[model samples]
Target: MPRRTILIVEDERSLAEVLAYNLESEGHEVHVARDGRDGLSKARALLPDLIVLDLMLPVMDGLAVCRELRSDARTKGVRVLMLTAKGEEVDELVGFHMGADDYVTKPFKMKPLVARVRSLLRRPDAEEAEADKVSGAGLEVDRERHTATAGGEDLNLTPTEFRLLWTLMRQPGRPFSRHELMDASRGGDANALERTIDVHVRSLRQKLGDRAETVETVRGVGYRFNENAVAAD
Candidate 1:
C-alpha cells in the first residue's frame, strides 16, 4: 500500500493514458514512455519499482529492452511485467531468456493488471525483512544492501532471481520444492505456475556462470544450494 514508482511503455496512446490514470489513482507515481527505446532510457534514469512493457514497440522491441536493462548493473534488479500480444507470446518471452519477471497477455482487464503490479511490488519485501549478508565459496549475497556477486563479478539479477538465490543461499543444502520456491520468490502468489520456477532457476544458473554448479538439482525433489561449498562463513 505504500507509494510505488511505475513505468508504462506502450505505443498505444489510449492504453498508456488509462494505465497511468489507474496506477496514479492507486497512490502510485506513474510514468509513461511512448516506445521501447524511450522506456529503456526512462527506466535507467528513474529506476522505477516496476515496468509494464509492451512486446511490440516502435524504436526497439520489448525483449531487447528487457535484455538491455537486465545487462545493466543499475537497472537489472528492477521488476518487469511484460505485456504480450498473445498468450503464447508469454511462453516465448519466458523461454527466450530475456529474464522478465512476469508476463501478461494483451486485452487484459485493469483490475487484474493492478493486482499484478501490487503483487510484483511485494516480491522483495520478505527478503528485505530478512536482510543479512550470506557469503561462501566465491559468491556473496547481501540482503540488506540488495546485491549479489559471484567470482568477483556482479550478478545482474532480477528481483525474483535475487530472492530465489537468497532463499537458497541462506538455507544451504535444504532442497526446496518448486512450490516452496515459487512462494518465496513470488510472495505466495497462488496463481503463479510452479513450472515458472524452473525457468527462473535456469536463468539464474545461466547468470551464475561457474557458480551455477553450486545450485544442485535433487532428482525427484527440487534444487538446493551446495552447502559443502557455501554453508556459511
Candidate 2:
C-alpha cells in the first residue's frame, strides 16, 4: 500500500472517472487530464509517481506524449502505464520502445488494471539495504546515490533501466529469466510482459556503449551479466 500519486491522461470521461474512483479507493492520490497536451503539461507540473495514459486522445496522441515525457530529463524517470484500444503485439512494442513501463489493452477488467497500477507504484525504497555500489565491466552502479556510470561517464538511465542493470550486475554470470528480471526490475508488484524486458534491455545496451556486451542474451533462457567481460579494476 504505497501512497503514490498517479495521473490519468484519458479523454474518455467515464473511463477516467471509473479509474480515478477505483485508484482513490486504493489509497493513491490521482489526477485527471482530458487530452494529451494537458496530460503532458500536468505530468511536468505534478511529476507524479505513475501515469495512466490512453493511446487515443485529442490535441496530442499518447505516443507523442510518451515520447515527450521520455525525452525530458525532469519526467524521464516517472513510470508510465499505457492504455490502448488496440491489442496488437506491434502496438505494444511501439509503446514499450517509447518508454512505457506497462501496457493494458482497452476493454480491460478493473481488478487487473488496478493491480497493474499497484505494481508500477512499488519501487525499492531509499532506505533499503542494498550494496551502496557495484563496479564491473567498466560500469559502476551506486544504489545509495541512485546513479550509474559507464567507463567513468554518467549514464542517464530511466528508473526501470537502472533497476534492470542493478539486478543483472548484482549477480554477474548468473542467467536471469525474463520473468525473474521483470520482478527484480519493477518489483514483485509489476505485471510486465516478457517482451517488455527486451525493450528495456535495448535501451540499456545503447547507454552502455562499448561495454554493452557485458549484458549478454542467454538465448533459450533470458539475459546475464557476462563476468568474462568485466574490465580489470
Candidate 3:
C-alpha cells in the first residue's frame, strides 16, 4: 500500500506516541500534534490524508478543529476519525455534527482504529457514486464534491449529513431501514445510536426547505427519497 499521511491530534503524549508508532508500522506517515490549535494549523498546512482527533485539547477543542477543517474548502475533504474518552451519545453526536467521519471511544484497540481509518479512505460504492453525480428534484447531490444543494441553494451540511444524503439520494425509490442507513452512512457501527441518524435527517430536512418532503418517512420502516422529486428538479 502507498504511504498515506495521517495526523494524530492527541493531548496524551504517551498515547500519541504509541498511536504514531503503530500507524507508522502500518505504513502510514504519521504527524502528531498535542493541542487542537496546533493540530488545526498542521492539518491545514499538511493536508494529511486522514486525521485522528481527540475531543479534549488545549488552546482549541477537537470540535472546533473539526469545524475549522470542514469550513475550509481546502481541508473539507480530509477524512476525520474522532478519538475521545467520553462515550456518551451526545458527545459522539457532537463530533459527528462537527464533521467527524467516524468515532472511536478511547480504550480502543489500535487494530480497529487502523481498520476504521482504512475503511474511511476506501472508495464509496460505484453505483452510489454514479447516482450522486447529478441533481435530483428538491435535492442535488455531488458526491465527488461532497456537496448537496436543495432548491438551487447549497445546504450547509456536516460530512455525515453529506454521506447520508448521498446514500438516500442514490437509492431514490428504495426505502432504507434505520439500520441499513446507519450501516451505509456510519460504517455499520452498532455503537452508533439510531437517534443520530434521525437528528441528521431532521437537520437535512430543515436545510432542504421545499425539498424536505422528498425525504419520506416510512413510519416503522425508515426513510426513502422520492424519485419523482429528483426528476422534477
Candidate 4:
C-alpha cells in the first residue's frame, strides 16, 4: 500500500496524538488540526486521502466541515470517517447525511480503525474504474460520470443509496443478507439495527417505482437484484 495521507480533526490533543501516531505507524502521512476551521483549511490545501473528523469541534464543527467538503467539487470525492464520542443513531444518521464515508465511536480499537481507513480509501477509485467497463440489465452505471440510469431514466440517489445500489447491481443474483448489505452500504456496525437497511431499500424501491421488483427479497436470506427480471417502468 502506498503512503496515504490523512488529516485528523479532533479537539482532544492527547486523543489526536494517539490516533496520529497509530496511523503514522501504518505508513500513512498524518496531519492534525484542533478545530474544524483549521481542519477544513488543511483539507483544502493538502487534499488528504482521508479525513478522520470528530463531530464536536470549535468554530466550524465536523458537520459543517463535511458539508463544505461535499459541496466543493475539489474535495467532494475525498473520503471522510467520522470519529465521535456520540453513539446515538441520530448522530450516525446525521453524519451519513452529511456525507461521511464511515463513522466510528470513540474508545475504539486502533486495528479496526486502520483497517476501515484502508478499506474505504481502496474502494471508490477502483470501483470507479471498474464501473466504467460495466453495464447491466438496461441500467447503466457510469462511475466516472458519477451517474446511474435505469430504463433510460436517471436515478437521483444520495451517495449512500448509490453505494447500496452499486453493491447489489455489482453482485447481481447473489442474495445479500440485510446485515451484509448494511455493512457494505453503511460501514460495518454489527450493532446497527437491521431496519436501517430496510428503510434505505424501501426508499430506493420507491425511487425505482414500477422497476422496484427488480430488487427481490429472498425470504429469510435478505435482498438480491435480479437482472433477469427487467421490470417495465
Candidate 5:
C-alpha cells in the first residue's frame, strides 16, 4: 500500500500519541492536533488523506470542526473518522450526518482502529477504478469529480453516502443485503455496524427528496435502486 498522510485530532495527549505511533508504524505520515481549533487549522494546511477526530475538544468541538471541513472546498474531500465515547450512538449518528466517513467508539482496540484507518486510506483508489460517471432516475454520480446530483441539483453527499448511492445505482433492481451495502459503502477495512448502513440510507433518501423513490428499501433484506423509477421518469 502507498504511504498516506493522516491527522489525529484528539485532546487527550496519551491517546493521540498512541494513535500517532501506531499509524506511523504502518508507514503513514502522521500529524497530531490537541484541540479542534488546531486540528481544523492543520487539516486545512496539510490536507491529509484522512483525519482521526475526537468528538469532544476544547475550543471548537469535533462536530463543528467536521462541519467546517465539509463546508470548505479545500478540505471537504478529506476523509473523517470520528472518535466518540463508547455507546454514544447519538453522537455517532450525528457525526455521520455531518459527513464523517467512519467512526470508532472510545476505549477501542488498537488492532481494529488500525484496520479502520487502513480501510479508509484505501477507498479513493477503489472508487477511481469505477467508471467516471453513472446516472439514472435523475440521479448522477461522477467518480472522477467526486460529485453527485439529483433532478439537476447538486447533492452534497458524504463519501459513504455517495458510495452507497453509486453501488445501488450500478445494479438497479438487485436487492442488496445490509452487509453488502455496508461493504460497498466503505473501504476494505471498514468495520461499521450493520445498522450504520441503515442510517446512511435514511440520510441518502432524505437528500434525494422527491426522487427518493429511486432508492427502494428491500424490507427484510436491504435496499435496491428502482429500475422502473428511472424508466417511468
Candidate 6:
C-alpha cells in the first residue's frame, strides 16, 4: 500500500504522540500540529489524505478548523476524523456539519481508531464495485472521474458526503437504513453512528440547493433517492 499522508491536530502532548506513533506504525507519513491554527496551516500545505482533528483545540477549535478546511477548495475533499472527549450525539452532529467524515469520542482505543483511520483513507474508487456514473435529481456523480456536479456546477463535497450521495443515487427509490449508509460511506463495520448519516445527508441536501427534495427520508426506515430522474446513460 502506498504511504498515505496524515495530519494529527491535537493539544494533548501525550495523546498526540500516541496517535502519531500508531499511525506511523501503519506505514503512513504522519505530521503533528499542536493547535487549531497550526493544524489548519499544515492541512492547507499538506492537503493530507486524512486529518485526525481534536474537537477542543486551542487558537481556533476543531469546528472552526473543519469549517475552514471544508471552505477551502484545496482541502475541501480531504477526509477528516474528529476526536473529542464528548460522546454526546449533538457534539457529533456539530462536528459532522463542519465536514468531519467520521467522529470518535475521547478515551478511544488506538486499535479501533487506527482501523477507522484506515477506512477513512479508502477512496471511493477503492470501494465496492459499482457503475461508473450515476445521475438523478439533476445531480451527477462519476466515480471514474471523481466528480459530483449539480447542473454542471461542482458540488465540492467532502469525501464522506460524496459517498453518501453516490450510495443513495446509485439505487434510486430504495430505502437504505442508516447503518447501511454508514458502512457504504466509511468502508468498515456498520456502527451505531447512524445519526451521523443524517448530518451528511443534510450537508448534501444543502449543497443540492433546489434539488434537495431528491433525497426523501422514509419514516422509521432511512433515506432514498427519488426515482423521478433517469440514471445516466
Q: TM-scores for all candidates?
A: 0.53, 0.54, 0.53, 0.54, 0.54, 0.54
Model 2 over residues 95-207: C-alpha lDDT tens digits?
Answer: 99999999999899999999988877776545333344677877889865778998778999997898789778876887888866665565323356878999999999998
Residue lDDT tens for model 1, 90-172: 46656247877888887889999999988988886444343356776678887656789986689999988987897787667
Strongest candidate by lDDT: 2
Ranking by lDDT: 2, 5, 6, 4, 1, 3
Local distance difference test, each candidate? 0.79, 0.82, 0.78, 0.79, 0.81, 0.80
Model 1 residue 127 lDDT? 42
lDDT of 5 by residue, 6-66 (tens): 8889999999889988998997767777899988876764556799999889999999999
lDDT of 4 at 222: 90
Model 1, residue 20: displacement in angstroms? 0.7
Better of 2 and 4 by lDDT: 2
Output the TM-score of candidate 1.
Answer: 0.53
| Better candidate by lDDT, 1 or 6 | 6
For candidate 4, list the clashing residue pairs, or say none.
Answer: none
**What's the true lDDT of residue 56 in model 1?**
89
Candidate 5: C-alpha lDDT: 0.81
Residue pairs in clash, model 1: none
Candidate 3 local Cα displacement, residue 77, angstroms: 0.5
The count of residue-pair clashes in candidate 4 stands at 0
Distance (Å) between predicted and true CA of 34, model 6?
0.4
* Model 4 alpha-carbon drift over 4 Å, by segment: 126-233
